[model samples]
Target: MATTAVINGERLWSALMAMAEIGRTPAGGVRRLALSDEDRRARDLLVEWLREAGCAVRVDDLGNIYGRRDGDDAGATAVVCGSHLDTVPTGGRFDGVLGVLAALEAVRAMRDADLRTRRPVEVVCWTNEEGVRFAPAMLASGVVCGRFTVDEAHAARDQDGRTFGEELRR
Candidate 1:
C-alpha cells in the first residue's frame, strides 16, 4: 500500500499573497523587474521565509538565492529544484513565483512530516530570468552552467545604464 501526503494549499496561498505584496502594482499585478529594489525586497522576504523553514540559505556571487535542506547523508549529491523570482515590468503574480514558492512549500512539508532522504534538497531563486530590466535573460543560470562568463553576465546593463553587477552589489 502507498501512502499519500497532502500539500498545505492554504500555506502556499498565503505565502504567494505575501510575496505578491512586495512588488504589487495598482492593477493588482507584480512589477518586480530584475535587480530592482522591489526584487531585492522580494528576495529578502523569501530569505526570511526560507530561514524560518529551517533552510540554510545563501546567495551566490551573481545574487541567485539558494535554500538548502540537509538530508541523512552528508556526502550525497543534492537534488536541486527551483525557478526564478524576478518578474517583468508588469508580470502576473504567479509567473516565476509559483515555482520558487512550491519548492519552499515542499521543504516545509518535509520538515513537518519529519521526512529525511539521502540527498540534500536545494531550492534556488534564479536571478534575472526576465529580460525586462536586464537584457539576455537567465543571466545567473547562464553563468552557473558555463553558458556565459561571470564577467560577461555582470557587464550587462539596463536601459538606465546600471550594470547588473552594480545592482547585485546594492
Candidate 2:
C-alpha cells in the first residue's frame, strides 16, 4: 500500500460551498428536506466531488451515497465513516455536513498522497438523518444496519403530513 497524500483544503472547502448552495435559506441556513429537490441536488454535488477525488461511488437501495477507496486487502472489512446529507428546515451549516465532508476530504487526501490502507475506506452519507421532512431520524443507517425495516421508515410522516417515501420521491 502506498502512503496517501494530504487532501487539498481548498478543494474540500470548495465542495462544501457548492453543496451548501442547495436549499440555502435567506438567513444563511439550510432548508433541505429529506428526499426533496434540494437534497437531491446536494447529493449530486457530493457525487461529483467523490468522482473528482477518484472514488468509485454507488448509491444504496435506500439512497445512501457511498464513496469507496479500495484497499490492498480486498477481503478485509471496510473502514467506514457515516453521516447524513439531509438537513432540517432551518438547520445551520457545519452540523452533519462537516462529518460527511471531512470523510470525503480524508479519502481525497489518501488519493493525493498515493497511500493505501489494508482495509477499504468508505465515506457514507446516510439518507434522511435529520428527519425534518419525515418522522424520526436516522433512516438509511438504521434500515441498512437492520435496526429498522424499510416499510417502517417509509410509513413515517413529517409535520406537513408527508410520508418518508413520498417526500423522498419528491
Candidate 2 lDDT over 1-170, as tens digits, reads 45547768898788777777888889998877788888888888889888998889998767889999999999999999958878878888766887999999999889877887889999999998986666568887889989989888878877778777776666
* Pairs with steric clashes in candidate 1: none
Best by lDDT: 1
TM per prediction: 0.95, 0.90
Residue lDDT tens for model 1, 1-170:
11333579999999999989988999999999988889999999999999998999999899999999998898999999889888988899999999999999998888887777779999999999887788798888989999998999889999899999999998
The positional error of residue 120 in candidate 2, measured at the CA in angstroms, is 0.6
Displacement of the residue 20 alpha carbon in candidate 1, Å: 0.9
Q: Where does the lowest 10-residue lDDT sum fall in candidate 2?
A: 1-10
Over the full model, what C-alpha lDDT does candidate 1 score relative to the true structure? 0.90
Q: How close is candidate 2 to the true structure, as a TM-score?
A: 0.90
Per-residue error (Å), model 1, residue 4: 5.9
Task: Report how far off residue 18 is in candidate 2 (Å).
Answer: 1.3
lDDT of each: 0.90, 0.83
